[model samples]
Target: MKHPAFFKQFLITICLTFFLAPNLEAQTKRIKRPKSSVGISSVDNYVRNSFDLYDKVYKYDGYAAAGTPLDDDDIDVLEDALDDLALISESAPDILSSLDGQNAFKKAKATLQINKANKALKYSVKTAKELLAGEREREKDDDDSSESNENSDEESDKNINNDNSNDDGEEEPSNVSDGLEVYSKYDFVPGDKILFFDDFSQDFVGDLPSKWNTNGSGAIVKLNKVEGNWFELKAGYRLYVIPDINELPEDYTIEFDVLTSGLSNQTSSGARLHIVLSDTNAFSNGKTHYAAVTLPLGQYAAFNINAYNHFNGKGGMINSGLTADIRDEVKNQPHIAISVTKKRYRLWVNEVKYVDIPRFIEELDVLNYLKFHLYGLKDGEERVFIKNIKVAEGGVDLRRKLLREGKISTNGILFDSGSANIQPQSLGIVRQISQVLMQDESIKLNIIGHTDSDGSDEANLKLSKDRAAAVKEALVNIYNISADRLTTDGKGETQPVGDNGTTDGKALNRRVEFVKTQR
Candidate 1:
């Protein structure tokens, strides 16, 4: 029996009561606080009040300054200041609040200065420690050098005393006072007068006069004056040789005696007493052939036959091809004997047969016209002695016996289609070619490239050029073959090995050929 206005007012009252009831219960649930005798209890109350004020200032200032980007250093400083201010507010909030804003900022600046000073002191101490360590290392190096010098001086004194003692009595055959004994087996050919001592002594110095020159270090040829049967050829050098020869022997044997004063750890390139016989005219025109026995002091000796035409400004055979490590017992006082015939090359060191390259002479025509020269190599100022130089001849014809072995196939592989890229599978064939070249230094080659008729003549021509270039690159880059020694040409479809009618024939048509440019 209520009016409409009364009903609406009653509904509004019920909704309001429902919302307000939860909040009122929450308030009633709070624990009652005890009465404090010291005002606001401890620092917890002060910290809360200060935080409220800090939030207002930070919000208004936008973290100290409006629109300023905070770098890492700046952020660190602000964080540290906030932590300190929080601690102060907790313990002494009333005093902190009583201070002026300027005074608070001054306190923060003082704290930052102290931190910077501490960091600087740490760096200064580190720098001082490094300087001390450097001085200590330098002192250690000086001590080591002094010790080494003293050892060297002591050794030199010992050597001098020994020499002085030997000088009084009958001197033992010192390396510098002895002459080497030379002998030969071959009878001289008709119209041939062998010169025994042709500039063998050190008659000329500096760069080896005329045909004689050196390839490596310590290359000298000198004459030594001696008493009694000791006539010494003082060779104070590392590697010395006569590059050019005017005449060469068809059959001969050369023997010599060598005495080395000292031996080095470095391998001698090809040090020996050499009788180099070559056609001097042939050498000037780049067509030279020669054979010699290389006596590596303190090491094993070997006989070699070389027939290659070296152009001007090009390094000769001794510099590039010779490999002899003469730093052993045999290097001190060794007797070397080399005998050459039409077919065989033999070498003996101290009555021991060291090299027997059978039919080596037949491999190349080394003895046409002949010249004789003496060469020695010393890596430094070390001295060497040569005695007993002789030449004669009587040897086997091993070349005639090994003629069949010379006919071994030197054929190589061919390229594919219109591409210049060499297939990985072709490596075997390329390696065979490399082996042939390496075995015979005198051999010059013409590498020819060809193509099948599948492509146009012009395209095939270009393809052929690319294929030749690719092969050359493989040999020179991958195999370490000398670029100067290689000659490449492309014939395109002009030269075919087989018919172009079928797949097999087309494959055969695309091939490369290796032709010997020299005998």
Candidate 2:
């Protein structure tokens, strides 16, 4: 017969052991290794190789570099590798959650980092090559100019001495380096087709295909389908149309098929396909910043974009000139390819490369508006058929090629309290954010403040708002970010990033986020 106190204590211990044992076991299970390996092959191997390449390249040069002579082939390879690595990295949380041993996954991630580094290295080499080529060309031109001057001086002296001046004595200087051209020739593996033409059978908001919106003509996109495909409005001409405004590398390739019926003489105006860079929505009225390609009914042209000082009226959209002639070619069957690198923009008709525009524009201001459809002038019934559209980024170096071009930063501060005041210890974090913002004037940000579910809804909302405002004030008053450029919002407890029950969950929930809003 055991004492009553001892028996009660034993019972309590049994109950706790029964309930808490599985939880501890579950935690251990979460970290366990998977039985089957996520094999390293094909793109995985490429990633590994990329990391090795980056290590070697960076060892030679302190900073990563960009690729030279941008072309389709190399762009494809680099983009494919980036896509793979991005997919893998994005899926990491899910994989870790399901697996018992997450150590292997970490190893895989290590491999991915290496691959990214290598891609950067490749780009750096490309950029170096371009610089070297440009330098050599300049040197050669200087030499030729010197020789021509010497000849002219000799001829002038002779004329003065003999009094026999002849116009025929002047000779046209030969362009010795005329044929010296560099072309990027690396080929990329074709990417998996993520988008289908059928998917756009209905109009919708940016990126989200399921969320439908009425078209510019107050008609739903689903009702405007022809031959099982929805009619897509030209990028610039349509009042409301889906725009492909995604961030892209400085050197990349864009290819698509355009099917169009010949334009009607009365209403046949060409549409503009714009590649803009800034933070604003290009489709909105009076958008100021963008770089674009205007494809007329029978012609193509390029433009350099800028914005007016004031936001009251439509900003500048200055047209450069017609790049090529396409009058002989009818619409609806032609495959068009536009390839851009750090040096030039090249256009291709069908498979034949035609227009090679030299690198006139260095950095387009509005990179966010990379893709758009320009509408033709005629309204009766001109349709452009698009198919097999592809985008790719190329080069060998990973860090320089993808990460640097992407401009992704991983430095920021996280707070545990939901109050608006900046804690004394968090001064360093505030300074870091301010410094980065100051350094990149072109950079814009979305500052979001969040809170855990500990206080009343109204109080939390105000607190979050106050916190975001506090951060914004600090940035503006202390750091000097223009009030107009910075957009601040407080979501309060409405957007809890993690669970509210656990301590770690609460920690993650009470946070502020700064997302780069501009290119």
Candidate 3:
């Protein structure tokens, strides 16, 4: 207590020291030096720096600036510049800032130059594509001109033939007009439920189809002149296999579109397509027994069936007698339809019945794998394209379907190729319906006709109506069914059950339906 002011000063100093000492220690601990020796900058700043570099490197900005003309040789130069720019941009983050911003500026310039080079490359590629497309189109035009010239010659030949008409001066019937006559009495229909269908719309060009495999090289290729992807079979005797999708029912149908090109002419003497069905999952396995239908293509085409059937607990090869050659229907694209009813197999090319095997397979369950084999290939002289492969389960009881659902839709009743005249074989299906009607006297039916989207709407509608009336007439005249109990109507190519772009869909669309008016 000698001096009060001294004591107060000493107290203040002690308090200040207590607070300041801890704060200074904490501040020193909180400050951290970056692990790397190089100074770091924000990502925003880094990007901005790169932008500045890009502006400096490329004198011009943007891709579309009119640059110097480029040829194929310039592709390499532009590609190299692109690569260097990419490397510089990748390495820019690691550069030390102590040196002048030369490296950063260079990187920014590269970025801009890279962008410009990309634009130039794209333009060059586009130009190349356009030139190639033009060349193809010109080639197609030349081919078309040649075809037109050949047609003119054919017309001249026809005119000569017309002069030498019948004894009564009637002009000779042209093959084009008489083509549909071959399809008369052609009654081929698909099965009931579709099991598998593929148009190859999902497939990638220049690659093998994911859904199909072949022992020989086959690729999904687009015809420059044609629409859609086609399964291009490379060479002879190769099995283009659609591996087992589902077990075959007792009654099933298989339909596909086949385009046989590379033929010398429409009547060229080389064309054979063998469609085989095997019992095993894999066709290549030794244990598999197969039944095949061989169809020769072009004019004068004949068909035969060969089956290795398991008879008496053992297998033996059975071949059917060759059929009479129907003028080869495979000119451009032909729809091939085959119906399998237990042991029997019937095949139709377009609308003409090609083969009817009463006993093709011994058992229905013995069939699983389906494949197409190209035969009669003369040293890579021919090419085959197949699309729209559809398989469906068969055996629909018409009476049952009508009774259960109040309506029965059928593809079984077929007509002449482009006419309303019902095929003679279609009477069998009508007979079944008549029997049902006879057993149930109170049943009344509305017979409806449908057509595929292959023709004009007005024509299709007229054809459908005529066909429905024809069915009614057949039921009344041939089957002795009551005219009063039945009514007829037509819906032409309007309501479709399947894709119109496909052959199977067209087949399904072309059908006769029976709707129950009263039961």
Model 2, range 116-195, lDDT digits (tens) per residue?
Answer: 33434444454333222221112235335535644554454333323322243321211111110110111211111111
Give the runs in model 1 whose Cα sits over 4 Å from its true position.
1-195, 198-249, 259-262, 266-277, 281-288, 291-326, 363-379, 382-387, 393-519
Best by lDDT: 3
Evaluated at residue 430, the lDDT of candidate 2 is 49
Alpha-carbon lDDT, every model: 0.41, 0.42, 0.57
lDDT of 1 by residue, 1-519 (tens): 224464344334433443443322110111111111111112223323333333332332232122233334433343444444445434552433433433323333222322222222222233222221221112234335535644554454334324422222322222221111111111211111232222233333433333333443323344332211212333433223433433445565555555555454443534444444443333222244444444444333332322222323343433222344334324435545566665565565543455566654433454543323223445344456444344433232322222324422111232322356453323444555555666666765667777878769998888777777777777776566787777888888997766676443455566666666645
Could you tell me which 10 consecutive residues in candidate 1 have the lowest summed lDDT?
A: 27-36
> How big is the positional error of residue 137 in model 1, measured in Å on the Cα after superposition?
30
At residue 487, candidate 2 shows an lDDT of 83
Give candidate 2's total backbone clashes: 52
Residue runs of model 3 more than 4 Å from their true location after superposition: 1-184, 222-228, 264-271, 283-286, 298-317, 396-406, 410-444, 447-513
lDDT of 2: 0.42
For this target, which candidate reaches the highest TM-score against the unseen true structure? 3
How much is the lDDT of residue 461 in candidate 3?
A: 94
What's every prediction's RMSD, in angstroms?
A: 38.8, 31.8, 34.2
